[model samples]
Target: MTDPLGAARIAIIGGGIVGIALARALTLRGLGEVTVFEKEHRLAAHQTGHNSGVVHAGLYYKPGSLKAELCALGRVAIREFCAEKKLPYREVGKLVVAIDESELPALAEIERRSIANGVPDLRRIDEVAELREIEPHVAGVAAVHSPQTAVVDYAAITEAMAQDVRAGGGSILLGQEVVAMTVEAGRVRVRTAVSEQVFDRVIACAGLQSDVVAKLVGADPSPKILPFRGEYWSLAPERNDLVNGMIYPVPDPRFPFLGVHFTRGVYDDIHVGPNAVPALAREGYRWLAISPKDTWESLTWPGAPSLAKQHWRMGVDEISASLLKTRWFRKARRFVPELRSRDLVAKTAAGVRAQAWGRDGALLDDFAVDQVGPVTLLRNAPSPAATSSMSIADYVIDHFLTVRAD
Candidate 1:
């Protein structure tokens, strides 16, 4: 059955999980004639592909927040989608461990938050023995175990979404970088590097370039995006038995980043230490992969100077860990005492998170979506954005799409 608005032309920028998910949803609903414009040749090339692929169980976010709501719902939705599509979905579970008495308060806070968020099968284990039973190699005085927290191949999911979009008569235009967008009359005119096209509605999910894209569409320039590079190190294949499931640290309440921890991938590969370091470039994976334009924009942002002054100590620590592999291993070794420097030998892929910051240097923690004329800009979607992609698509379509009374 075709929707009444099937004739409407919709354009989505960015080909990450969120963008692809939105495309799939709109096309499947027959809501519009949808087209996805991805700057990269392949989908999920940035944050989507580079993330740890953990389906969040709504632990850290405050109750009633978008992150809490979407993550709680999206995990179940994603599991169902993966099952229907015959994709890899592993419910190996996760343990948020507290190594000492000092971290127990934070762990308890997480437990409280998790319960309020209605996370399934969540339990707070007080005994070290119980923690050991859950994660054999993990050493912690207390732990909050979420049995339903799972992992999946999000890149595969993104590709599957693209396929779904194509099967539903939608087009995915790869390598088409959107330079500018103008709202003329009632339609949005999107100008890409290759060509110019007009869309009934344009949704930009540009990850690293989100702020830039939003500015291009005449949106407010506050809450500028600062790209923070997360560097991961793969555990040695021989030491695969270090942990059975995901082992995350009790995140510092002061900082937005969840500290360096362990994650078991869908393929049974273990990864450690995605320390948050300010990237010199938006797409900077390595220290040398610098972009002058990206650097200049970040350095000059009103929030950057204030942010630096506030979190200089934490920033310095992350930079040191990024430069020295030993420093990174030391951070991880706090939870898993047996995890040696040799275990953190292999360098895995790096991801740049587009974290939004206010003029006062405060980090924006919740989901941000706004409309400017005929265009909708997804300003900030960090960590669990991929986890909540399907739900987000639903939210966007329900709210952002304009009704044409014909």
Candidate 2:
């Protein structure tokens, strides 16, 4: 069979998992001559490398949404990929606990969503004894358990995918930031500081700079990338017993964040946190890593007032926790009563999430994609993005690329 896209020239912006996954998908299928441009000197340098490494089990997402659908399919794909590459993949399981009766209603809603989303072996544990069976130190009135929730090294997975891309005849260029783009006559001419290339199609899976890249293609900027930094603290190795697998709080439905929680990483090291706080820069990983321009843009955005008005309380709480270890420790102790302040020894390298917010201050909850001429942009792909990379690649190709072999 002849490959219709074999003659096509394809350009992928961003060297994160999603971009690399798309390149691998296209090259493996003999779809096109694929080239990936990454601004960073290495792939997965940003979101892909900085995450908590959990392969979510479609528990919290709204049913029928892209997150729910892609996460389900993506989990299986990732497991298969890891098996194929002999990478470490551990089904550590996850427990979402409602600390008190007040949180029960919300926990029930999560249970409903989990069941509706077909979370495998999902069980609602109302008795404290039942919850103890899973996480012995957990303190909660009720909980929902997903035994299939797992963890893996996403950065390793991304590198493995890049290997496949190379094996399949694709090219990945590092430190090639796409500074400019021009879409005309059904082709996109992408330019970096050092080089320029024209392609039949360009797809940007740029995590943090998605909106900025979209602007290059003359797309809407309403869904602006609002970088929210999530900081974690490493658990003392001796205190790793505090968490059996992963213990989480029933997330506040009013916001998109999952709140501070504990995760036993794939390597059996436990870490706590990821409180959502506004980042001072697009790539701000630490509090001191500030950019005045990025700060000014967010403060002056049209939706600034509305967002502040709606989430100021949460903003204050999260910021407080970020600044003070005691506040964060209290939140973590709620899930595991045995968690001591001293147990959370050191703060880990933080991750900045590219949360998309509209002009009206509504944070986009579902995955968003936009098409500009032949350029396709992923505007909002947080949390499960690393998990959903391969599925997202298949989705974009099937729905947006609009090409098939003859």
Candidate 3:
């Protein structure tokens, strides 16, 4: 007879990037016997699959925030990990361009906070000539260069991390969606659609459905997950050279979406977009794709009234930009004069950001995780999360051990 638990002391829910990375971390620490549970047949099916693959350079986050601190650390850690794995990655650099005087102030703030966050060689270049020399196709009144930034296939990184997890004696069960979990006698009992498993500890990283998973483990589901659809438009192959690097617009402080811009991915595709719009479904990618449960919960939640009141104006603007293609492209054309309605050749993909809204209807501005018994729930991890997975995993490990000791 075999020991039924599949050789792991702990179970990692959701084989997304964070969970896969955590599984790898646990194995590397010689704390083996870890199992990854993924509902999807393969890894990187959702958020990791839809990522822009821009390895952020630690700019644009508030000074001393988790996003800022972890990004500075993650850039180095991810780059090194890529190298060790012989994966394709580049420190290709990035630029946040301010189209006019009004946006310059925010650009300046970004620069200051970036420095405060310890990003190296970050500087403002007002000279049009200098800007043209770096990326000839991009046109802006001024630009801020983030020389430390890079791009890679984030899905590949997730896959590599999964590989490392298995190599280190851990296992992953694909197509195993954890339908329910309960704590009994100081252990975790996880019920999947196909099977049931028990572990000494459980860590869930279900991205869009984080709130639902949290509730399944007996944690309060106060910070409701709000889905923001970020749609992208890939430029025609002929138009790629015009957008030479990651050309960004100065983001509006009131909104989390970094405004539609140009990104030159590691695959040599110059993509534009990520217009932030309210997603009708947690996984809605197109118009009319609505999830009744998600829609009802958000509208009826006590916290949503406050959140809507706070960002009602911004939400309206985002929706306008999303529905009106002309309005959205006009934003991209600010930095690239050559951009036209025809420049957008392909609907590359879109991502749904899991924004956490509190019961009072306020947005959660930081990373949040909750644990009950042997089950841990990840609530909110947006933006630099892909960049900060390693550090986040370390923090989770520390918390798990500390709680276990107690």
Candidate 4:
């Protein structure tokens, strides 16, 4: 007789917030066995641990998109999860400031999307006096205040979710890099550098390597993952009082990357930045952190040339900001006049965004997921993904997993 556990074994690749959340959700749904494979020695080592820690209010997504729906519902879910776990969740709010009359149209569009997305306690302030009441030191002709926007430690939340998985008898295998996958005999063989295992089914939330992992399972690779590095500068400790909560610019509607902004963490330390610049490698954090293979993969893609031709100006500006500290600080100073170059003295850890781009050069603007054989792939999940981790998990379980609780 064969082992019954083999019939019920389920594998999840990537040990970030999404994967751990999925593991816990599946275990709670009465799955007999679940295993999480993390290449890193610890979980949340990539995007989960490197983000600005803002719990998005679902204000910037398209009204009816998966990002909009999931982020709204997920924000509430995160609050509840934090409360239950005794984690810190601070409702410090957010202000999207429009510096001049030129930005009003974009700001108005954002407001429309926010309302349609059912964002609660969202208000518009056109008067500088009213804006002063919210962000006293800011300079903007108009602004949208999202009072429900909050912040939390996403890595901590991910760890807590992992605990739930462990408590529920699931296994988390660390430092296991998945190298290949072969689906046959109604089970998928998942291979790592050190070992190989056969699972009844697999779901990959591989983040930065999502495209590569999907390709291993025979998924289409039209939308290649392009790595964009977002580097941050920490505000001087004494200058932390410059901003209350988060202050953002009216983003360029044409692009997916949000402009440089100020964010106050749960620890009350403030950071300015995250300028979008092309990274030399997939996981590149510094300019010198280069990978010849990763660079070749990006440069050789059909979308790379077209995307460069389309947004070369913006790309140049982003690279300029990334290289020149003064240029970056000047952008942040537009909203907060008091912010000086000296205020942004400390360098914070940078994050590489795994942005998906089509062959025609359009940046994919929504959460993208698809199925290939016995594997379900979360191809693109950016920004509010941490806030929407639990919701995405529920979506995958309820829709993608055919082997559900009876």
Candidate 1: the clashing residue pairs are none
Steric clashes per prediction: 0, 0, 4, 0
The residue-by-residue lDDT of candidate 4 on 1-406, one tens digit each, is 2223333789999999999999998888775589999999999999999988988998888888999999988899999999999999999999999999999999999899999999899999989999999888999999999998999999999999999999999999999999999998768999999989998889999999999999998899867888999899999989887898889999875453568898889989898878888889888889999999989988888888888898899989999988888889888899899988888986788998888888787889988988876788999988889999999998887677754321
- Judging by lDDT, tell me the better candidate of 3 and 4: 4
Q: lDDT: which candidate is best?
A: 2
Tell me the lDDT of model 3 at 168. Answer: 83
Q: Which lDDT values do the candidates have, in the order given?
A: 0.87, 0.90, 0.82, 0.88
Model 3, 1-406: lDDT tens digits are 2222233488888887788878888888766489898998999888888878877877777787777777777778889999999888877788888888888888888878778888888878999899988888887788789887888888899999998888888889999998988887888888988888778878888888899899997688888799988889889898777877788888765454658878888989888888878899998888689999889988899977777888788788778887787877888787888888898876768888888888887778777888776677888888778888887787777665435512
What are the per-residue Cα lDDT tens digits for candidate 2 across 279-330? Answer: 9999999999999999999999999999999989988999999999999999
Which pairs of residues have clashing backbones in candidate 2? Answer: none
Residue 137 CA displacement from its true place in model 1, Å: 1.1
Which scores better on TM-score, 1 or 3? Answer: 1
- Candidate 1 or 4, higher lDDT? 4
